[model samples]
Target: MGVCFSTEIKDKSSFHTGVDTDGNDHSTNSSKVSSVPPTPRSEGEILQSLNLKSFSFSDLKTSTRNFRPDSVLGEGGFGSVFKGWIDEQSFAATKPGTGMVIAVKKLNQESFQGHREWLAEVNYLGQFSHPNLVQLIGYCLEDEQRLLVYEFMPRGSLENHLFRRGSYFQPLSWSLRLKAALGAAKGLAFLHSAKTKVIYRDFKTSNVLLDSNYNAKLSDFGLAKDGPIGDKSHVSTRVMGTYGYTAPEYLATGHLTSKSDVYSFGVVLLEMISGQRAIDKNRQFGKHSLVEWAKPYMAHKRKVLRVIDSRLEGQYTLEAAHAVANISYRCLSIEPRFRPSMAEVVKELEKLQEPKETRPRRHSSHGTRTRRLSSGGLAAADDAGLGAYPRPQASLPSK
Candidate 1:
């Protein structure tokens, strides 16, 4: 992780201006689109509602400039995502076919996520409407092609900020970091606090996209599922998700639950604090895995200073670091009951900023304000690296 201050100094002004107390943004549309709120439905029920012909392939290809190399936004197990435009033939927006940027996720012919996963995305991103969740504009399923469209996220993924190395990892200011955490927590809270719990099976830095203002939106619903209930213990399924972030218990057994998400979130919080990936080649033996390495240190705040990223220096509050670290430790607890709900996580994260009431009566943080990281930087190499990070508090793995 090499998010260098030296490289980003030229763009520092852009970063500072993002944290305004003014909730009013010049670009935001005050006019709300009135529509009947989607009726509540389980994941399966929502999946059934995706209408195939709503988005034509011709429109998608045209909007994406025939999936031009430059139009590419991101990629995943699903497929390449391209920046696309609105046709307005179907929805008839004011913009019509011009200047309207949307992200088009075209599914690979033979993707690991498969058809069930596509349905899952349609189900969640389709029905859910929250500021913190990526807005799924629509999708296209014509013959073999399966494409998903989402609102364009200007700043790219959270992974780009936390662990991508060089300028990408350039230390985020304490304020922006807290803001990102709060936004992500709000999205997860919206998911888990619903009458039905939806487990985000794949919650990692790469899936958390940022707009121009550094606000986070949770994406990648292909792996999400309804979390366990009753004494059901865990929802069993084939193991999936990125390495270095999967929960130990779920990895050991197919059994999954809402707490699995909590564990993944703990890993994410650790990444934010340390400015390091969970596992990087730079780490010494026994310290390579962030979960195993940091457990003991997080349990004791006296060692907290050792775990925080050196790049931060005096920028962050030590007390704030300890508070968030402790919360992460609990989130990663072996027992599901010990883990806090997403709503609780959101509340704790909100406390990191200040009292919600403290903002000026008029200008509050409402719409997004993103600061772009400088694009070019060294991704990784053998570590000439930062020193040690401590372990989280000792706790037994659940049976």
Candidate 2:
């Protein structure tokens, strides 16, 4: 399950609108178009503008097999995501494993903040179409029931691949990790681009969903906020995000910025490199907080092995590992201004994807042979450099 914090939406006023419920022009002045389009004011108008299918409660209930427990894909604070099938063309309910597969997130009625978050997801995802961002198929808002339908992510989340230990959850290969990281970074870069300019307040591993080919797509826009407008530097809001992933300045002053998302991305990148949770209380005193524990190792060239995942022993190259560590270290900088923009981060990650010649193994003082490398420069390490470090047993509870 994933976690997120909630804050009250200050202004609930409606905005300008033009679209109709069915997304058709019922207006008599269809020929005349305004140079400036009207902003979406009400929920219905916003939903109308996107041209998303308006699904009824009965329609979704049929699509999700009456919301059976067996059909569930995952659960979070907002609701349970159930696996379902729907018609590819008509968007109607279909038998399981047939037609197009979809994930139906049925909002928990008891959650006071769920409705606002649901709308936020619809608002952002409905309008924005990006390969790295999860696709919003449609939505359901019949009476009090609110549900969001999204394209099915067969491989699940980056969180499970990094932390979960089981046959179903395999540790992602080094190359795959880099691929996922780059894909996620591209997603963030798209959101942070001048046209989008949205701050993804919550950017943990769990929100990074994977498709069959292991391509990463960012999901859950509940905490996403519009970037500071005009001369404003940051959007002042209540501190809301997973504890370990939230940026320090945002946590202290409640000023949210795109740099805040960069910090969270660094935390996720660290999690991928170390195969550890961001906030693992079960670890030893000095190792509880992943960022704090790994900072020393990340900065030190030789000591970098102490933080790299043992499971990824021979999978990554030394130079590539160090480069990724440096990226994370810079992104995790205390000063938000010091953090590199997502676009810059994307460029650095893209460089790592380039093919590199393999270098011969070298032996350390401890006599353990360096691990073999397939690409990305020199070989990694064995038990020589990586000291006996205990893996964290517990993870932060999902909200």
Candidate 3:
């Protein structure tokens, strides 16, 4: 389910009252108009000031072919995504397969998300422009209708690659997985380090959209919020995010920080490594909880291999596998402060792409013998160092 917020305009005529959101009447008084107009603050004013293209219900209907069932790309709690076509330059309605493809998300009027969440999505996506982030083209807000239009992503979402079953789905290779991880990490890092600092409260495989070449972009910014600034430790917000992906601290205390997003990324990383959903009830009794069940194996040098996905068929090297699990382990630290920053995580992921011959190895500080790396980057199980794994200074306090 989506978060609920009230911000809809009840009367369309109230928007064109010639009064800015600040209650300053700009309309002419006795045939005399003001020389300068006030800045826009309301949804209508903000949309006009942004110069964002506004589509009428009729225009979108023509573009989406009246929301045909076959055009549906996917559906979620928010609403259904439909495939549509638009003129390349003008963004006008075009015949199917004749122009640039677009994805139209028609909000479910009965869904938990209302105008507030919808406006948040537009406000964020309309302003931010990054290669790792999905592009928002325009929006339609005719009467009660709320629709978002975006550039078409051909390959769909990372969730389909990681969890979807059947002949139509293919398991992501180690190289592709690493690529997706790196791309997603870059996107999150961008958000956290932006001038205004955005916290992607929702980070999961499904929000990671894939292009034709397997490039990943972050989508769905409805749950995103401005992060804390100077002198502020965290932002207090109502607990909202997907189950299993939310950070423990954020879930418990409603105090959100960038580290909260790091924890969510860790969950996604774990999913990538183990080929399991964050929460699955279909697994064996004790193993249903991916994070809880994988923690022990992740900490055990000899048993770490057991947590890896069987579908991979030993495609990855021993050292690389341990390194990934180590990263995941650090990210999943119970203490939020113990988790590495997104920038640090990105650097570590990037290092994994180095040639095996040039990869560095460290000896255990406890004097445990180090294993020599094979040509395939495999190391002896006994040589693994669980002691080298970083841990929090003390046990975390409960909510």
TM-score, model 2 to reference: 0.80
Per-model TM values vs. the true structure: 0.74, 0.80, 0.77
Better of 1 and 3 by lDDT: 3
Question: What stretches of model 3 exceed 4 Å from their correct place?
Answer: 1-51, 167-169, 354-399
Ranking by lDDT: 2, 3, 1
Whole-model lDDT per candidate: 0.61, 0.71, 0.68
- Per-residue lDDT of 1-399 in model 3, one digit per residue for the tens? 121111111111000111232435445321112111211121423354454677877878889899987676655455667778899899899998889888887887864424555777777788878999988888998878999888887666676566745443236766678788989999999998947488888788777877766778998776677887779999876555656777888867778899999999999999998889888778899977689989888966658878887666445666777888888888889899999999999999998875647644433333443443232221121122110111111111212
Please, what are the lDDT tens digits per residue for candidate 1 over residues 109-228? 754324556667777778778899988888777898877777777666666555544532354655566778889888888888747578887677766776766788888776677766
Better of 2 and 3 by lDDT: 2
| Per-residue error (Å), model 2, residue 100 | 0.4
Instruction: Enumerate residue pairs that collide in model 3.
Output: none
Model 2 Cα lDDT, one tens digit per residue, 1-399: 232111111111111112232344323231111111122321333456786877888988898899887776555546667778899999999998889988887887865445666787888889889999999888888788888888877666676556756433235667778989999999999999999889987788877877766789998876678888899999776555666888998867767899999999999999999999888878999998999999988988778988898867766667778889999999999999999999999999998874545433432434565454332221121111111111212221211
